[model samples]
Target: MKNHNVFIALLHYPAMAKDGKIIITSFTTMDLHDIARPARAYEINTFYIVQPVDAQRYIIQKQIDYWLSEEGRKTNPTRHEVVSMVKLLYTYDEVIEDIQKNRGTKPVVVGTDARPYPKTVSYQFLREEIEKRERDFLIVFGTGYGIPPDLMATFDYILEPIYGAGDWNHLSVRNAAAIILDRLLSRNRC
Candidate 1:
């Protein structure tokens, strides 16, 4: 498994390239401060908010257990890799408030893995609209019970869901964050 200390260090310094690109990592895990760090980094940020009903210690423990399991060990490998592998999870309301607080004139927020799928479209359209207006982008994902239907309706996009090939869902979030960060960084190079 990833060394907890290394994961904490990455959270301390989320890689930000010279261009105006930002990557935020989050999960259904215990470190809220780590998740919030990225939000503070980007003028545009993404969040994974968990539903109130599912914000119990048991769920967090489950995530922790998954992190320590054999597959988790394989995925994280070492402490230096944990920050790159997992996201710091947050409560739904906390995410919304953070977005509202950090959202500037040009901000986009995406709620991924939402039900009904249309929310994803909304996020895309919102991005287009924000670009048209020359605004920033802020995206949010839902964890635990997932985003509510009403909130999902307002998302700028819905991330394509990736079912684990027999692994835990939490791992999917970590992998997604890494992929997203890679894409964002690559595009920024141009």
Candidate 2:
């Protein structure tokens, strides 16, 4: 498929904790590698790591910097390629600003969640929407429990939950991202 103006934003701040309190989630190093791989495979424009904490952002930036360095590239060229597409930012606003600055248009923010919201759209509908490619698309994924309800209300669309054959639906952010991307961009019927 042709490269789409699609970006992935993995948010770590203002996420809902298990206790229903808003908290900042820790950035996972594994998510950086796992999410970027499928994103690159699907020809996404960029993969953004959104963390508000300075320490967390710094740690992720260090890893990104190393991966783009000569030694890291020499050690793992494949990883270097994927890491090159990751942009670490301090807030969700920065993500939108960066994309707007680069793309000359604000992206259509699509939120991913484990539960269906009133604005939830099907995978097939979203697939058709992004395929239009009239505007940039930013697929947002939350860490910890999930993005809070108030924040989710501002998103352009919330994708329907990825259900399985049974009632169980919890999925790792990385796995959900890969599955969601495939469902939206894959050649086969979803």
Highest lDDT against the true fold, candidate: 2
Report lDDT per candidate. 0.40, 0.91
Ten contiguous residues with the weakest lDDT in model 1: 1-10
Q: For each predicted model, how many residue pairs clash, with residues at least 3 apart or on different chains?
A: 21, 0
Which lDDT tens digits does candidate 2 get at residues 120-154? 99988988888887878899999899999999999
Estimate the TM-score for candidate 1. Answer: 0.40
Instruction: Name the runs in model 1 displaced over 4 angstroms.
Output: 1-103, 114-116, 119-133, 163-171, 185-190
In candidate 1 the C-alpha lDDT for residue 127 amounts to: 32
Q: lDDT (0-100) at residue 172 of candidate 2?
A: 99
